[model samples]
Target: MPTEISSPIQGSLVAIVTPMHADGALDLEALKKLIDWHVVSGTAAIVIVGTTGESPTVDVDEHALLIKTTVEHAAGRIKVIAGTGANSTKEAISLAAYAKSVGADASLSVVPYYNKPTQEGLYQHFRAIAEAVDLPVILYNVPGRTVADMATATTLRLAEVPGIVGIKDATGDVARGSDLIRRLRLLEKGSGKRFGIYSGNDDSALALMAMGSDGVISVTANVAPKLMADMCRLALAGDFAGARAVNDTLMPLHFDLFVEANPIPAKWVLARMGRCNAKTRLPMTPLSARFEPVLEAAMRHAALL
Candidate 1:
């Protein structure tokens, strides 16, 4: 009989931004600084080169360099979940292999985007990566960006795949998230193979964790790592009231970070804190002037400023 595989991560995981210079070049120094900050801030892990990190713009070589640098700098202080997802299954496998070789603790592989593969294809795609790489794989489902949602059934099916440890549920559909948890419990009992779900959305993370989610893979954590870490810790510890209290302070950031497409407003706040230069790629424009006050107000509310 196969023993149960408990989740290795559970807490505030920052879907961190890639700090770039004003000229739009990668700032490895700033990246190291952020890693140190997360280690001190009690962040459980970091998902580097994810959506907020502008993975689309970074070429494959840059992707590997970013992951390798993060793993080296992190140096066991915090878990590094490298964003190794790609629309090409072959590319995804290669990236995951590179992550494992570089000592990354895990890989966050988003559902293949634009291709819009079927549910079965999704299973095969993720299962292939799990089989190909020895590193832990966390399935990322954000249909808002991917255009292909991984249904609960597909996730339930993928649960049986070895090396596939957990998922990041960004769908923000609480009812379905609850349903997946309920079903997973039954499945785990039958197979003795366990998996977990982490909320990919910060605003509804409390509600999801209240039901059964392990924690959050958060964009809000980019600026307010301490508060996000505290909230996840409280929620996971069954201190809903305390978590709620902390969340009341962060509620504005949860909504405001997305006010100008993630990492834009998030970078603005980080820059205000003098953490980074707040530069983004070409297609992803700078944070518009009109929304600055809204984000500023959020930063003040969260005490990030």
Candidate 2:
């Protein structure tokens, strides 16, 4: 077996929501407040403009503004990780470069969506970004969204690429995650290179971490920041008992947030908590009224109510 992958960028990294106004304008003040909340709530990093942040809908200018605003306002209170993934290799490279220029600590790049590239295509896609950018690139493999599952072997190949620091495994398959972690440990032992393994699934985070995942890029943290942060901290410290206690409260929120396709329910919950307004872009609608009570119950269960 391989040894541990010691990375400082560990703990609950929140895949935060992009707050918007009633007319679908970016509510930047609300965004800054959310960042502050995460900072105080013990969240280790803020992944802005991510899937949860509606990165797909935001225009190019909006994207750059979001990254710039996050980096400027965060002011090193916490790590600001810009979501710079684009299906186009050139676009991904440009975004990553912009993130680095603006002082974003790192960039989270997802698998190329819609193209359904082969394993080699995936490797080249990511390798290109690593070569072109000086920033740390954390690969995000959410096959469910991208429709392109990155095999363990392909991930291992990319892990060796310079500037490619880690990955957010959103596949939600604990067995696969465990196997990858073990192999990565072995790789690290030989290469003396450490790659951060972060779980993108909030519900399954503890399980992956139990098998040695470094941390999580969590949607649940967008709502229950303190509890999520506490769980990650306790679990990473080998106190599963304490982590589970915190996780039990967050478990319900985890499923509820996704009940309406990410930022929908998440934005709604935050608005109810007076955190931000519940406004999503055109293609994405507000949380269905039917699920509001259900999510509210979950919020209450987690004491966010």
Candidate 3:
């Protein structure tokens, strides 16, 4: 079996929402406040400009600014993982280089979307980015959103490459996760290299961690940072019963946050909690009125309301 990897970034790394004004401008003040809240709430790290942050809508300049601003405002109080992935490997390289220049601790690069590359294509795409940039790259494999999935073999191949440290498996298949863990253990035994595996699916995070994954890059953590962090700590320590108890309370938040497309519901919950405005870019609309009460009930269930 693989020995522990001692990952620097673990636990509830919130894929945080980018706070926006009613006019759809970036709300740096609200973003800073949210970061402060995460730090005090024991969140492990902050993932900015991610899908939850609407990276698809934000222009390149805005994307760079968000990453730079987050790293600066965070001021070493917490680790900032910039969502620098792009469909084009060249674009991703540029963004990741910028992330490195701005002092971000790491970069989360998602699988190439829309183009639907083959496993070999996927390998070259990520390898090019890793070679172009010096920072640690966390591969994000969320085929549901990205359309192109990185298979376990491709992931293991990439794991051997220097500068590629870990992955966020959002496949939500426990069997697949378990198999990957088994394979990684064998690889680690021979190479003695530490590889971190984090769950991208919030609802399945406890199960994944119990199977020896490192942590979660969570959407639910955006609203329930303290509970999510505590749950991860418990789960990592092999306290499944304790983790399950915390996960039970958060189960509602986990399910409801996806009631609408991601940040829509997440933004609404944050606004309801007086954290940020419920504004998102065009293409991505606000949470529907009907889901408001449902989300409210969920928040109440988690004692966040």
Candidate 4:
């Protein structure tokens, strides 16, 4: 059995946004402040360079620098999970190694994207990464963009690998997520060690936590860290009512934040909050005016202004 972390990463683990200057460069000063804010606000963990960080746009050097800077800025105040996944297996290995070198607590590796690899391919791709690096690996199965979803069986298989820890199940399919939890628990029954399961979808996190998920790799937490952290804490403590109360307050913002592609609305909200400037790479753009009223109303409802 693979040795598990001493405790589950319960509560909000923010898939934090990368702070960018108006010139399209990473704002190290702003990034440090965001980390300090999350730590002070009771965020359980800090996830840097994930989808919300615009990983697709960040070059390898910048990506490594982001992870290193975040880890340094966090200063052991919270866990730092580096987003090191890439469509190319070799690239993933390279990134994972760098994350480990920089003292990342774990590596959140997404399922291979674009190429649409088969299940065997997914297992091999992740297996290669785990084998190549000693860092604890959390599989990221975000099929909405990745196209290829890592199935429960494959995730379980990878969990058997020495350094592969668990997954961020983002299929938005509750049944599949429940089944994966059952399977991992069953593995623990015989092996005496359990793996962690975190939800990738913000909306489904409450439900998944009700079913025993450890926490969520949340994009929503970037702007509303305290509420999201409180929600996850309540859920992990089996206080579903409390979790729901926070979720209900956050529901509108959550829905509106993703009215467009992730990081787009997320960036806009951060800018509006004065946390960071709103800028994105060529492929993604600012939130359209059509969605402005919806987001504004939600923000007002949340009293974020």
Candidate 5:
């Protein structure tokens, strides 16, 4: 277990999309440019190959390359947290170990989707990954996709694991997120084990930060990194009024970005901005043109255009 992992990252961390060429090949040049853009735009961290990055569509070698490329391009300018999770424990461990090998700052292990593991099983799953890798592990509990939730108690237990250092609470239930924050604070009072709590829900990030969450692992940040980072900066600094102002401006963009499924709207927004190609792996598609004007107007209003 590496106690040397710095105080968990704060402010907005973007789950960046993996850029691909028109031929469907990994666009390494575009990928490096995106990584550089995040660093320049004040993104606190960059999570490569996460859900927003279309992790499910990528094979293991591509996954490892994404992490390695991101870390290389970031060049210690920004923290790189790799999405090294899978339903299989062995595969997850291998990915996590690869993340460590490639010098990633941390690993985001999302809950096993489609499998619906019990609380005990969830704990064991995360604990095994933490023990297997020497890097800090942030549990990702997105019930929306996983179809299963890792309870606060389970997260608290995993907090005891030497390498399990934080969680990305995407359940979107602010009360539950607040409860988990309170619980982690109480547990840390005695153990000296600090477990960071980051909201995976872009909508509830401000509220969660108000309740003592460290920051957010944001999907919205992929396009609006500066605004998202500024919001988190304000909230973390106890400037709720300032944060709310930024959040309010971003509200329309946030809501509309999910007009379809995640990456669809997101990639569409990026395409409109000319940032990425807007190409997503199958089972996902481009945002409908009917919604284009709607998102474009929202982006204009948000001043992201």
Candidate 6:
């Protein structure tokens, strides 16, 4: 079995974008540069090939290569959480196993998309993956995209599963997130095992963390890494006032990055900053020109411009 993941994986884990050239080819060189930048910029972890990274568009081989390349490139300087999710269970297992082979620290397995599995189905789906591989798994529940939402009870149930370490709750419902945290704390008191709850929605991250979430799986962190990192640090350290000050600066970016579908705006901003090309695969397009001024103003508000 793979070694157990360490407790308390927390802070600004950037749901990083996969850099692509104008022709939509994977930009491996640019990826390496981004990893180095994250390390220096104090990003707590790198979540590669996630929704923000356009996971659906990449083929299986491309997915494996991205995970492998990121783990290799990070080179122990940062933790790489490979986005090894798939709507298919077997496929998710295969990708997760590949992530394990390539030495990723953990796997962020999203709730199955499109199929709309029942809660029991969701439980078995995630459990099967955890049982099938030794890799530590973090459950991602973003019903907005996945359609199938995992309930807090189901999440608590999965907390009992060994190797299922934490969850990224993207429902953007703070009441739900805070309630889950309360229940998880109760469970920890009884079972002596820790279960981390991370906010997957950037706009509500500060509130969630302040309400006792572990940290954020942030989309905004892709562009504003240092500021995001600092905010998360302050939030986790229980300095909500300081964290709020930083978060206030980032609030505009938190909302605008999702002005289009996830990565479109994120990639555009990265290109503007000269970090990477703004190209994305089909079904996902470049940011619409109409939204540029809106995004640019947000960037300026965040001092990223």
Root-mean-square deviation (CA) per prediction: 1.7, 2.9, 2.7, 1.5, 1.1, 0.9
Reference-based TM-score of each model: 0.97, 0.97, 0.97, 0.96, 0.98, 0.98
Q: Residue-wise lDDT of candidate 2 within 1-305, one digit each (tens)?
A: 21222464889999999998888899999999999999999999999999999999999999999999999999999999999999999999999999989999889999999989999999999999888888888999999999999999999999888788899999989999999999998998988888899999998999999999889999999888888999999999999999999999988898888887878898889899999998999789878889989998999999987
Mind giving the per-residue lDDT tens digits that candidate 5 earns over 1-305? Answer: 45435477899999888887766678878788878888888999999999998999888889989999999988999999999999999999999999999899999999998988999999999988888788889999999999988988888888888988899999989999999999999998999877788999899999999999999999889889899999999999999999999999888877888889888888888877888788887888777889999988889888987
Error of 4 at 132 (Å): 1.5
Runs with alpha carbons beyond 4 Å of true place in candidate 1: 1-5
Q: lDDT score of model 5?
A: 0.89
Output the number of the TM-score-best candidate.
Answer: 6
What are the per-residue Cα lDDT tens digits for candidate 3 across 154-227?
99999888778889999989899889978987897887778888999999899889888889999999999999
**How well does model 1 score by local distance difference test?**
0.90
TM-score of 1: 0.97
The alpha-carbon lDDT assigned to residue 288 of candidate 5 equals 85
Model 6 poorest ten-residue lDDT run: 1-10
Tens digits of per-residue lDDT, candidate 1, 13-43, equal 9999999999988999999999899999999
TM-score of 4: 0.96
Predicted candidate 4 versus true structure: per-residue lDDT over 6-55, tens digit per residue? 55567789999988887788898988988998998889999889998999
lDDT of each: 0.90, 0.92, 0.91, 0.87, 0.89, 0.92
TM-score (C-alpha) between model 6 and the true structure:
0.98
- Which stretch of 10 consecutive residues in model 1 shows the poorest summed lDDT? 1-10
Pairs in clash, predicted candidate 5:
none
Task: Give lDDT for model 4.
Answer: 0.87
